[model samples]
Target: MTALADQTRWLDATAQAALVRSGEVKASELVEAAIERIERLDPGLGAVTLRYFDQARSAAADGSNGPLAGVPFLVKDLLTDVRGQACTDANVALKAQARPADADSPLVARFRAAGLVLAGRTASSEFGTTPTAESAAWGATRNPWNTALSSGGSSGGSAAAVAAGMVPAAHGTDAAGSIRIPASCCGLVGLKPSRSGARTAVESVMDLIVPSVLTRSVRDTALFLDIARGDEGPAPADGYLAEPGKDPGRLRIGLLDTRIDGSPVHPDCAQAARSAARLLESLGHHVDPGFPAALGDSTLDQLFAAFWSAGMGDLLADVARRLGRDVTASDVEPLNWALGTLAADLSADDRQAASEGVAGFARSVVSWWDDRDLLLTPTQAEPPLPSGTLASDPAEPMAPLLRSTQFAPFTPFVNFTGQPAISLPLHTDTAGLPIGVQLVAAPGREDLLLRVAAQLEAAAPWGERRPGL
Candidate 1:
């Protein structure tokens, strides 16, 4: 590889695209470089489950001349699809028998229209049931900072790939912090747009899932939201946002340095939020130790699981139908299989109650924004755990999901509430693992999130911090 290509691996998507637009680097060269990195690094990382190098090269040769044209992008092997690619979604059954998508999901189409080369599919949790990306199908996506640790999933593979400099940015779906958890672990920017954000039905937990990317910079994420948001998005026509610092003006920001259940967060994670709050206060924003009361409602967890399990069960049933057989313990991950059985047992009344409960909870969560401009919290309850920390046990299928409550409790509620939230790499654990401080804005207020996120990024630049291989 040329020295420039080596350097390009570390460049953010915006910079890489700029090089292509300036004629300093051919799109094909960028694709080839990424392919080489994937080949060299993915063997140990397991970040990529499939490679479509030839297709990416072809697109780079003659694809849309959109703003991000020529940047290599990987799609998570979940709901979103790249036509002709087998989106396994990190399931053994799907990996073995799923057919290729015939057409792109709207988000994928937007990605292509903006000139992003579809490089491959990244690993995800089986059906995106768990936060960690370890599965029997694709193994684990090792964190670039510490290979012995998980990269965080169901978007863990995409996060690992980007953090490893294998790709500038990669598509990831956030139903319950899949994008932000991995972004926090990998030291990238993970944004989950409003529920109406991208208009995709992937992992639709009451239509809670939203599509976004894990990028190295807040501006890249901002640019992506502009390009990929649905027409219904509050500002679908928003242009590239600039960080004027003072433009966003003083705002009311609350700091909740605890898990939503009123449980204490990890020392490092709590400190990260506190530190971010202090920084925001320094930047002329009002920061207080308060969060939405709705967030403290532990009953919402049951409500979410009631629907989440049903959705998982239905997905597994569909997979079985496609494969012409039942998906048993051997076929599905224990955690998801247990959840599937829970779904199978849910009755009409059960679903209706869950629906009502979620609606009420969302109203309460959203009401917090009526008075507060934003809520800042620790993205995860703790830092990245070691490999197999969240792996499911066949004898106890629900163990992993239950354990996730301690590992990742703060993100899922945002999905249920349909608010826009971003996880920024603001602090690192004593061991040097990245700690993410989350910022959430009201529905359709992604523009505000971006502006404030850019201010934080400028005040505490994290883009230059790279993990040692």
Candidate 2:
């Protein structure tokens, strides 16, 4: 590999930190390296939405005092508020409203305190209502694995940046599979912590939105979580970086190859799930092909849709009013427009029912995890699709793309249940695209999940495998 390629390609956050601490590499150097890669590759990929090079250099100079000192990373534009950088929700209506944040969002502050150099902001769908990364304001973020395919969204830009070797790791948020989907598409490790673990103290708009990180190795994810996790309570008996506890003692893993809503997984994806099962068995874990009792009901999907629509309505109303726009249906993407329309028709009773339904679903799902430590499933129903495949006019319908892509089925359950989940780049399709296998754990069990993930990573290291630049 070329020098830049060797340096930029998949150095886990831990490795990068060690290099920085050892004085082998300065934070500024890594930031400059990432900026150079972004400059060279992002033109064709369209992954980054904003650049903060000057600020990054300044931060890197002073960042050595923090835990993640000298490691460069990108924050997804959807939720993070970087001071003086544009926090546009990737919407044209919100473009001119970009203003310097008075303070970092709580999660952003934690990242900064960890000694991470903030390189820039990554792209996302407008309002983050869509699964693909194509935006009216920032254009499309193509998959780093395949320029013609999507990188996945609304954290697509972050995933693309990490997968393309622009950075060792980047911050991402997952309300409904945003982090994992893109990580799967680009062949990276993505972890969505339990809602509580990633909760932003300031942003209460969507409690379901869990902040996460996308990385090329499991250790990077675990280390990032160690730094990012809340320290409100007594420290764990052991730190998150503690080694895996001897093979998880033959896990009773529940494997669901089919979609949660009874939809069939793509043939390739099903095969991937089987492959993962074999791997688990090889590791001495008992894998049973069965659905969680909580997943038997389809009502959870409708309930989640109701909650999702409500969030979209709130965002549309707030952003449109703030921008002094008329807030017509045409101002948003098709999926968002449909959601907003549904929100308008929802009654107080409907809102109550949705909340109750979600709460009940959460309780039931948590109960399932109480029995089994891990839930294994396909990260997505199929492999990454081409750009514009999920795009539609704001006034158009949403059912086609929603069903065809099988979006949100497997992922939202964890978000709703406030459980930790991770997508591991374990399998690939016929076209050589990465297919991630997801592992979910009960609330506050990130340590266990990370250990299992690390074990898998050791067995099958995917970091060295990269798409041709």
Candidate 3:
């Protein structure tokens, strides 16, 4: 790669697109630079699971002329689809029976329409059930900060790629901190927009998943939302680009440094949250150590588990119906099989109770916003765990998953509440791994999250930091 090409590593998608638009660089050059980065760095990172360098080059040479035209991008190998590419969702059976998407998914189409060149697909946890991307089908995605540790999953590969400078940004989805967790682990900015942020039925199908992006800069994320948000409904008036750092008048920000269920928060994670609260207060926002009453409900864990298992069961049942056979234990990973089996054991009444529980949880959490504009908490209960720490133990399959829930106790409630949340790489542990502090806003209030995230980014800039690898 040329010296100029190497320089692309430091630029955001917005700047890369500017180069293309200004005729200073060809889109093909940009694509080739990213392809080179992936080829050189991904062996150790294990981020990109599928490559489409030739197609990406072709698209860059003659793709749509939109805001992000010529910028290389990656899609997670999960919910989002790229035309004619196999999306395995990190499942071995799906990988074996891979089928190319007939067309781009709505989100992918928006990505293309906004001029993003779909370069490749990144690794994901099986069906996005786990928070760490160490699927048996693709092996583990190692953290760029420290290879011995995990790249937080289901969106781990995308986060790793972005962190390692393979690409400026990549697409990700968050059901329960899938995007934010990996972003936290990999030292990037991950934003899980409100359920209504992107008007697509794909998310409504599961009613939990929300498509988003992980980027190095807050502005890049804002630019993505500007380009990708739905055109139909009530959308942000002026869009998110440059909206960051704009004066977001003093606001009520509630601070909750501890896990709602009273699980022990790692010292580093607690310190990150405290640091973020102090930063917010210095920025003139009112901060208080308070949280929602609903978080204290012990049934919250059961409610999320039942819904998650049922969702997995729904997925497997659909797969079976399409394949004309049942998905047996041998067909999936131990954890997935266990979850599916548990889902099978749930009665209709059980599902109904779970649904009601989720509804009540959402109502209770929403009331917290009635008094506070934003909520601050640790992104994860702890920093990145070792790569194999959450691997499915054949001797005790469910234990790994339960441990994952505890690791990310603060993130899932936002999924149920359908609110906007962001994980910012605002602190580093003694070992130097990034620690993320989460900030959440009520539904349809992503603008607030972006504004505050920009303020934090300016107060403590992290864009220059890169992994040693």
Candidate 4:
């Protein structure tokens, strides 16, 4: 165990792939070690919701061929589907049905094409409706740094698994900040790529969601973007792996160290952003106290709620169709149940108006990037919250949903604007919990985010900072 740990436990996926390519280690050895690690560590973290160990073992027989070949991987139990796996999206009803996916989603197919061994599924909140990965179906995913704290959701399980060295990288989806928030909590690099060049994740009113992976290093994220994007859209064919190793060139970066409403930020969270701003300056980028003013407009919240609630209603409709019966309030988590109810009450015209309003706001906010290359902010409103901070009973079904606003105010707007953002784990709060500082790039500029993130990573060196778990 000690020798295997030394050989593979903390190596990033890129490093592991290099080993396989060099014939220094077989892909099967990597998969077996990852399986052992997950079995040893995941009980306390509640990260992986299902296991496909035998399948992964068989797949690894040829996983030694190329880049990322046979690397152990887990997909978040969200929208991305792997053929033959049951995608519950962290809901009990679907888990009870245990229906397997007939075909892989495009992104999952790309993951396989990259030679990633599909290990299993990680937990997410029901329909990805919450930040904390606490669902009645799968329970909570704990932070590897501190068991009592949450690994931010709905990508908590993926983030947790990566941080705990269960896997070098794992798939996660970000609608708002699911990728970034959990990456912060678990001290991993999570990138939510721009929607334009990435595969379209169509939700109800807007295509707000983007799929990404939570990884321990920026190069892995970049390499993944190269594979995941796969000659799609305006992105360069294959420079993602090389982008991070080169200098990002001096550029203007705007800083917003407060909540979107101009309210005071948590002192620790603010300091994390401030420190990152200084770090950026030291690295040759111009940093100023500037951000898009549209971020503060209250109506943005209303529009986002409308879009998200309508998406929830759509989720229920799909679930109902799957079950061949109407999905009742009791079928889902409380907050999402309430959201679907509100969505059921909204008129189509209301959704249309909300979409148009959000588009206007996106134009206004994206225009800020006309002069600036990036916007810097705290990845989360505060450090990772305690285990039950967002939990609520059915009597107060909307409580968790309401609390989510205060918890992740700085991140969701990036989704609404359809831009690319990356969260880099740079600082720790008083509790020794990881605090990620976000860097946002204009839409279709995930390459910029990766370059800057790589620059920061080189300067700060977060790769060796593993949790004690």
- Write down the lDDT of every candidate, Cα atoms only: 0.85, 0.78, 0.86, 0.86
Angstrom error of the Cα, residue 286, model 3: value is 1.4
- Once model 4 is optimally superposed onto the true structure by TM-score, how far is the C-alpha of residue 9 displaced, in angstroms? 0.8
TM-score for predicted model 2 compared with the true structure: 0.93
Q: Please, what are the lDDT tens digits per residue for candidate 2 over residues 1-469?
A: 3475466456777787788888887777777777788888889899888888888888877766765788888988886788667688887757756766777888888888878899889998877767778887789999988899999877899999988888889988888788888888899999988876432221223878888888888767767777776475332224665644435567889899987656688888778778888888888888997657877785666776677777777778887776776676556656777878888887888777777777777777678766787989988887888888777665456753475346546776777777889999998887788998899888888877887887787777777788888
Q: Write the per-residue lDDT of candidate 3 for residues 1-469, one digit (tens) a residue.
A: 5676589987989899999999998988889999999999999989999999989989988966888899999999996668898888887777888878899999899888888998899988888988988898899999999999999988999999999999999999999899999999999999998886322222122888888999999999888887677574333336777579588899998888877756569999999999998888998999998889988887677766788888888988876764568888877888888888888888898888887778777887888898889999999998899999988887898887889987998888888888889999999988789999899998888888998899889999998787887
Clashes of 1: 1
Which ranges of candidate 3 are over 4 A from the true structure? 197-205, 233-237
Error of 2 at 213 (Å): 0.7
Q: Measured by C-alpha RMSD in angstroms, how accurate is candidate 4?
A: 2.1
What TM-score, over all chains together, does every model reach?
0.95, 0.93, 0.96, 0.96
Error of 4 at 304 (Å): 2.2
Candidate ordering by TM-score (highest first)? 4, 3, 1, 2
Judged by lDDT against the true structure, how good is candidate 3? 0.86
Q: Candidate 2 — which residues are off by over 4 angstroms?
A: 1-6, 197-205, 233-238, 243-247, 261-263, 324-326, 399-401, 404-408
Candidates 2 and 3, the one with greater TM-score: 3
